[model samples]
Target chain A: MEYETPLFFHVMRYAVRADRDVIDMVSGNPDWEPPEALREGLREYADLESSEFQYPPSDGLLELREEIAARRGVDRDQVVVTNGAGEANYLAMARALERDRGSEVLLTDPVYPYYPGKTTLLGGSQRFVAAGEDGQLDPERVREAASTDTSCLVVNTPNNPTGAVYPEETMRELVAVAEEYDAILLSDEVYDHYDLSGTFASALGVESENRIVTDSVSKTLAITGFRVGYAVFPHDLAEEAKSRHMLINVAGSRPAQYAVLDALRETDPAYHEANRELLAERVETFTGALEAAGAEYTRPDGAFYVMARFEGYPGTLENVEALIDDIGVAGMPGEAFGDSRSDWLRFALVTPRVEEAAERLAERFG
Target chain B: MEYETPLFFHVMRYAVRADRDVIDMVSGNPDWEPPEALREGLREYADLESSEFQYPPSDGLLELREEIAARRGVDRDQVVVTNGAGEANYLAMARALERDRGSEVLLTDPVYPYYPGKTTLLGGSQRFVAAGEDGQLDPERVREAASTDTSCLVVNTPNNPTGAVYPEETMRELVAVAEEYDAILLSDEVYDHYDLSGTFASALGVESENRIVTDSVSKTLAITGFRVGYAVFPHDLAEEAKSRHMLINVAGSRPAQYAVLDALRETDPAYHEANRELLAERVETFTGALEAAGAEYTRPDGAFYVMARFEGYPGTLENVEALIDDIGVAGMPGEAFGDSRSDWLRFALVTPRVEEAAERLAERFG
Candidate 1:
């Protein structure tokens, strides 16, 4: 259990202090607005009875859970609305430990930093498999890394930092490995709508008893601040998930969930299509900028991040600080993710200034 | 750790299945209207710039933190807004364990069940001290129970289930005991505004590094679903609290924060005074009915719960079920609180029909 502060927060801290001119290509906070219906939903919630404002059920609002269950093609009882995808992930891992499924939670290298932090918080051990050069998890690698002691495997599709989406084949193999070890598969698909390629496949599509798919309206609706998320677990695990959800944070935001519910009713494929168009364009611009900067990097298959090795410098904390100071552009160093690639940097194209961020990198380090 | 579901949820589940007319004195879901300003706040928040809907900072919105800090007479940096007091409590206990301050979290018997559940989730042990006959903590008893192995003491003032608000002298003595044991004192003041005795004293009223006061707008504003709460920590402990807060739930609800921020800005003592007046009326009516029923009970000093022992009936789970089934009134069993008071039943007078619930109990058992 390392006490390393995740790099995104560090960059945000710097960004908060940095001059207004500085470009914050750091944290994965979406800059886009949530769906208009979600905004309108707040107005509708405002007009409802005050009971709507009071403490919702510890599990969640039934209507919101119903909406999520319908969307995920699961029964309403299988869904537990959460504080965010963050809380959902925590519950999934905690359930694995509580049920004696395993003692350790496993993930791949270049993982989401908070996964490890959460595992430590629950007093569970963590192990990692190494992803291939493309930063996409190899099924064989995951199989090799897993053991009978592994309690859960956390998989992030349309992955953060590397922008690698797990395909259907990869997802099945991952599920198989998890089942073999009696491990739970925690699929964090918060970035599902950010996929630029057509090959993205959700673990939910595979339908395993061990799969717990966690997601939020953060990236899809661009309302991370609303702090609304949900997870779908096997029916047997629902009670534990609900209890853990309540103990962890009580319940998700009620008004926000209502807003999301309203948005859900009105959400069109065009809405997701439109958001992907924006993220997809930004990925191209960001990758182009990386190429111009003479940085060695893999083009992202999905999601909105690009990982580039800063050839001349170590991606140490000091180097990251220098990059933030010298170039007026902020990004997280690869060291923040794990010991997997201390030489690279993670650039998030969540900002509107994707092209300028790209140009700035080229001008500063090319 | 036992896999005991808290009595609130169990009772709530029963209430949900029982007749619609069944008086739900089970959970502390406040059944009053929030201040008009709080509702107006939602509309104002509804119209805010879209950035308000986007992810707020992991710590919290500065405006909300500033409001909380001002109310608590602390610097803004001392506050970390949370999902609710639930998450705040979790973070405080987790910080105690992580820092090696103590190995076990101590509380008075007839404790809030979630505290022990959270300790178990964090892989920490829980210990208990027997509370006074009135369900109020006695300093000598706490001192006797505490040991060097104690890491934290969770005190819910104007306490839950029992509704015994800790007075200033007792609070000071409790703080002294905690300081002696090098244990953090987590004061849950969510029910601070419900004081009927006018003897409410805050742990924050006596400043010390060991005192981390947690609260939420849930009980105070009757907006439990909004999921807005905060904890005031010593500046040294603030960092750990913030890290745990982020890892647990990332951030509090965004639009809910905005709505609460607006409410805080306009909240007058008159508002709380009005709420207390209503609760005071309910308490008198409910307690009178209890007396008529030949039930022995403690009149709450603060908060809206009453603990009563029905004549010649042991308040076990089966008895509680019979009470709900026969009387159409749902209340929690005292055994659900802790092992200390198996003969008593806990009743929440949060609903408007407090007199009806009280009357039904009298008719059934008197």
Candidate 2:
């Protein structure tokens, strides 16, 4: 196994230096604070005696699973809490691919990088289906890419980098394709709550036996450091996913799960709506600036990112590095997302200083 | 690509709830409270801003790694925090086997079940060296097991189930074998602090580059639920372990790491000593009761477990299940540990109800 370093995070580390006044528009970390209720839940649970800190039930705490199921409108048995959305994705892929030798995975071009990284590492090949010019995943392309060798299709709705939330029609079509091909659909909805368009489509309700939904509170509840995430599987795959999840990390942190339970139980819908509005404001301000700077870009429907192509600058790896070191503005090279055209860069909208980042980009490329 | 269910833990779960009033002496869980300082640290960290709850550094938080290094008496760069000792073991095995395709892992008979479980799952074969009647590992046996195919040796000091603390001289000899064979020594010292006879030994001080130590606060600090463990590896293997750790589960929980850090820094030595004394008392009482009931057992030098053999009863899977279902006392079947020809069952002595448990066993068997 030739292990590849997580280069995107590595770049983020380099860009977040103390001396550099860089405007970090890298990594999909939410800029807003977690809801007060959620934070208090964590605080309250943390203060409890250490006895409460023992190993969580291998499947997950019943309360947490029940809350997640209720929120997703699924059965509690369908959910398996994992280390994070990363582990959930890995488990879903492992469950789907391990059974079939020479299985290829279908991933949308410019998809979340981990889909390919994990697939390749797990002895599975990948087929990249290019997204359309509007920065939205094309169901027809995905259908065409499906073949006998493809065992899994990974779809990240409210997708990272492009923030293209799949509409219900698109999701239904994709789910239908997966059902037709008997391929497992691994849907990553980590950014589900960050949908600025408020039209988030869930793969869970897609009436397909092949769907596995991976999600986390990292983006929604802002508890990424807590490392609590989950997967909801069809009845057929739940046991295998549960077993693999136990093998992966035994269980995630106990206090984190308890906190998640409390948060889901107590958090107000107003908090989520307010956060979405804030992110929408940032996107507007930033995209307006990009237009002024004459950059070709697609405004995200959800998630906190924009895929912008600098007209004069063909965004190569060298250019990406130079922007971080020389220009002091950190963004992901689009090439990292997929083997698509490398002329685009991804700027994260989930930064506190979005206005300043826009100003910096304008200063350099206006 | 055929995946087997995790056998050891799966069996343990069955044995846990099989009987009413089952005295669980099977699993290696310590029945003690986490240090007050560690709990307080978690409380303090839980109240931190949501940004503090964002994704942790992939390798680990620097301060926690530094604390681990200082505790292990090694440089900070050598340590990488992991999900738990389980993940540490898995990561080390994966790294070792990944480096060499035909690599074989060596373990001792009556070993920690995870060694075999993880090795086999990671695409590596394992060879077991039998332990002496005294439950002590022989360095000569380890040397005999080493061959050109051997890639790593998994050793647990203050060994799990058996509780045989390997002497420094034996470790030195094993270290010599590791150096001569150019094989990595993956030492599990999760039970380091629970050494009853004050004879705990570590491979960290061994003058060998081919050594990795897997340990955690689960056993030492009595917070198994926290899932905070680490692997201290030679510089050559550090990067691989770190990368795998991140890919496997990103990192352990942030607040848990902070709690462990505080436990290491602020907790008094007396707190640890008190935990040790309590465990020691339980072991002594439990073993005495077993002996009076005509059960033959090895007195553990350290850790919270004792492997006992009943005179007439062979510790098969069926008998272990009967003990749980009929006698309401759960002890791990010796078969789960290894293929050794002994009627041995494991007893965890960390429970607060040790005296009552002993009396119950005495009444049943005496």
Interface RMSD of each: 1.9, 2.0
In terms of DockQ, which candidate is strongest? 1
* Model 2: how far residue A362 lies from native, Å: 1.6
Candidate 1 clashes between residue pairs 3 or more apart in a chain or in different chains: A54-B225, A55-B224, A55-B225, A225-B54, A225-B55, B102-B151
Q: Per model, how many backbone clashes are there?
A: 6, 3
Q: Model 1, which residues run further than 4 Å from truth?
A: none
TM-score of only chain B in every candidate structure: 0.97, 0.95
Q: What tens-digit string does per-residue lDDT give for candidate 1 at B257-340? A: 888888888888898898899988988999999899888997988887889998678778888888887888888888888888
lDDT of 2 by residue, B297-325 (tens): 88888887777777677778788777777
Could you tell me the fnat of model 2?
A: 0.58
Give model 1's docking category.
medium
Residue range A1-366, candidate 1, lDDT tens digits = 245457677777886787657788777777877788988999899888887787777778888888888888889898888888988898888888777866888877888899988888777888988887887898998888889889899989988878888889999998999899878999999988878878889898987898889999888888878878988989988887787777768777899888888998997889988888888788788778778878888688777788888678877777777787787778888888878878888887788888988898888778
Clash count in backbone of candidate 1:
6
User: Model 2 - which docking category?
Assistant: medium
